[model samples]
Target: MSIPLAVVAGASGFVGQHVVEALRRQGSEVRTIGRGSVADATWDDPGAIEQVLAGADLLVNLAGRSVSCRYGRRNADEILRSRIGTTAALGRALANVGSPDLLWINASTGTIYRDARDRPMGEVDGDIGSGFSVEVARAWERELWDAPADVRRIALRMTIVLGAGGGAMSPLINLARIGFGGAMGDGGQKVSWVHVDDVVGAILHLHRHPEISGPVNVVAPDVVTNAELMAQVRGSMGRRVGLPEPRWLLEAGARIIRTEAELVLKSRWVAADVLHESGYEFSHPTLASALAEIAGRAPRGLLPVALG
Candidate 1:
């Protein structure tokens, strides 16, 4: 028996770093691809990418620009280009040197599903949404599936990932501390979220279960409404008061912050049917549990501060 080789692209991002550490802890040799000097291969050089990918047992591509910006013309174009271009590039590389034994897990978003307050969106029955974000998600997955590689591929349609140190938790914690932790807009939109630990766990689980392929929703089964989410945020931080923001105010604040309100306003009722059916037990299955663990790891005074 020999150690496995895992090649991870975009290894500098928050999630990517965790994935790399997890793989290394499991005794797998890790290679990274990015624009950074730490990367074994840069995206600019297709030859180097192919070389690094060759003979690797696993390939995880988390390459994509952050969508945490206002969707202006320039940012929107780069968002789409970053995702589709990197995915297509990997596809080309894999076509040249891929094998049936290799497994490619590409990053995707659960936002591809329509904003549904009516029902939960599953992989099989979820309705694809419209708009810029949805289009980007669609194109990102399309590029992955259209690849001519002989290897198995899984488009990880992840939802809002919460964790300590980085991710959506920081901003939310800030909002709570500032006394704006109340619900956004109507506060009825369903939020489908997963802990970062579960994201890593699901990836390893998928790698082990070769039978699971195609688009898989990497989210927790428990979904919470916007109001419920905010309430939990306040509780975790020991905040006594939280002022709710209406849609109009949210739009204004979004412009001020250079981020979109859809990030919080949209109803994302996603169901992890595949993970559930496939028996992937989530470590933080509920929003309460997830937030508690995340708050525990956060810096002192950042959470559980003196209530105001």
Candidate 2:
């Protein structure tokens, strides 16, 4: 029998590439679309993406503009417009073509929620965020939901994905290795983090067990404050110089870096009840162990056998 095919978008980004590799490991074929020349479709060519999706087993949309760019009306607007526009175009294409009964997974963000006191935010707990990241998430998710119901769909509200390769964790990991990584602001704000392996693993679960739908939280169970995270990184890296940047310093730095002061200084303690309750197993459920493995300080755990 032929293996099922998946139409994957955003093949150039960190998680997107990881997803493609994960699927390949599971013996599934993948076709992609994006500008990096890695994916099969370029940004403006919706028909190419649509053609990729036609008769495919899955449609995974992970395309978006990175929100870490320096803050400006134009820059922030581009971030929002890129996500909204890509999602809109994809949705229109999916609607126009007779979509297969394949599963559709749209990428969202944990930044959708406002701050709370270490509270574990869930799917129904509405208070979607207010910053440029939140705005992008809001519009991106809306366009995703606009698709026809014939294709089963789900939105993955992802947290800060950590690994040795790419993402928000990369710069921090490098600083930590040099004994310079430290808390951003007051050290009181929380951070929700997940291992890149677990992020890819959970999607593998979705690929095999298609019943899971709606907005799934792709994060680790334990959330940490900036102080605690810095402490762990310092301890794990065997470092002694990690320190806290004062709020004023971070604010000033944000302006120079072209990002919002709040992005660097704010707390985001998201959770993953959806992933847990549904029997989705996480390889690095804890933060310390996850950090250790990523830093090559610990042994790689037993690899899970990928399902078809």
Candidate 3:
């Protein structure tokens, strides 16, 4: 049998790029269908999106406006609209052209969970947060649940991805390399995160294991607070640093980053029970190991980003 084909909706984004690489590593023929791609059609054009999705063996929908900035009312509206619209459009397309029994992986976020004071929020946790991110996630999932009958679907609720570019660690790494690296806010807020490599791996795992459906939190099995993360990162960068950026300073930094300080400096220790329970093993689940690998320091037990 010939290798099956896969199409990633948001093919050019940070996470989407890694997902593409992962799919290719698994020997799947891949295609891109997003705004900036060389493809002539945007999903917004009538009958455009469905045509692209009709015959694919697998579909990974990661399309969305970037959440990297402070979301005012307008930005938040776009975020929700971009995701919901694409999802609904895809569903309509599948319904029309007769979709195959293929896996449809959609993007959700760990921020949908409750406040971080709860610490290590598990997958089974009933309460979800109600911020702008949460709104985008809830609407995205709703579209998937309401999708046409032929599409087999899974929602990979992602955590903050730590990678060299366009993920959590990039900006922080740049700042740290410049000696501006310090723990933001009180440094007490938990920030559950995963390496971008792991994000790609988790996506491919779900693609292979058809039973892994619904909302699987794609985060490191271990949890780390802001201070601990900062400390480990500083050490990895070879800096003996303890300079703390107060809450107000972080608020100012937020203005420059366009994203709010609360979003970045806030506590959110999300758990990975679903991914773990599904037999997904993490090679870099802890802060030290992840940092070591990212910093070009050789990590012993972990699968390096280069490996992914």
Candidate 4:
């Protein structure tokens, strides 16, 4: 069989970088689309995108403005536009040049679900939430599904991704190091997370199992409350104390840092129902194991140094 060709957009991002590397290691030829000159095709040129996508077996679109900042009017607009515009552009290009065999896995988010402290949200029965973030997620998936049915598509609804160099882990690690990594608010909010490796693994699994399509939750089976999460972070960092931040304090701190408090305050209780039922085992299935692996690979000073 001939080698598979994969075209990845937003290949410069943290998750995209990992996906590109994984694809390359699997011996598949990878092409990228981004504003950067290094990409095979830039998003500005529809013709170039079509050219790069032609004859490609897979297309992974991770293009979006990072949501780590304060969701001001301008930031919110950019976030929505970046995701929807990129997705629509790709959809249009694929409709014009893509083959039926091509698989397009687009990035979605578990934040699309309501702030659920009640139950875990899954692909089948998860209640769609409202607000700016949820609307963004909904619109993002809608764009993917709006694409022609002949082109296979999977909306990978990922939760908070934990990795060594970057991702949601960085801020938390920083918090722990600075003695501020305690429970935020009431600490009842569920933090549904997945290891970065599992994210890549789920992608590969979904690619091989063509039977699975639609919205698939890319989260680990294990979930934890905010208190438990921070406790683990403290444990991982060998910190004996972490100053918990109440809601008011958290909101104030969020304002000071220019980020939305909803990032930590929202109870994101999501379940990897499709991934579990499909028999895709996770490398870092538990919070402890995930943190251990991340801590191992993390920078030297991030964690407490051992003393004799």
Q: Taking the candidates one at a time, how many backbone clashes does each contain?
A: 0, 7, 4, 0
- Check candidate 4 and list the clashing pairs: none
- How well does candidate 3 score on lDDT at residue 267? 73
The residue-by-residue lDDT of candidate 1 on 185-218, one tens digit each, is 9999999999999999999989878799999998
Instruction: Report lDDT (Cα) of residue 247, candidate 2.
Output: 83
List model 2 lDDT by residue over 1-308, tens digit each.
Answer: 23388877887788887888878887888998777766677778878877877778877788877777675778777777777787777777777777657778888988888875657678776456686677777788888888654677788898888876666665566556655567777788888888888888877677666677888888888788877887787776677778577888777766765666666566786767677777888899888988888768332322222111
lDDT, candidates in the order shown: 0.90, 0.75, 0.76, 0.90
Off by over 4 Å in 2: 1-3, 177-179, 297-308
- Compared with the true structure, what per-residue lDDT tens digits does model 4 show for residues 128-215? 9999999999999999998753688999999999998887888888889899989999999999999999999998888888898899
Clashing pairs in 3: 69-259, 70-258, 70-259, 190-267
TM-score of candidate 1 to 2 decimals:
0.96
TM-score for each model: 0.96, 0.90, 0.89, 0.96
- Residue pairs with backbone atoms closer than 3 Å in model 1 (clashes): none
- Supply candidate 4's per-residue lDDT for 2: 33
What is the C-alpha local distance difference test score of candidate 2? 0.75
Q: Count clashing pairs, candidate 3.
A: 4
List model 3 lDDT by residue over 1-308, tens digit each: 22377878888878888888877887887876777647534785646666666577788888988776667888777888888988887778778877666778888888888677665777787468786677778888998998875767888888888876556676666556667667778877888899988887787677767676788888897677787787787788777785788988888867875777766666787888877877888878787778877788333232312100
Error of 1 at 106 (Å): 0.5
Per-model root-mean-square deviation over C-alphas: 3.4, 5.7, 4.8, 3.9
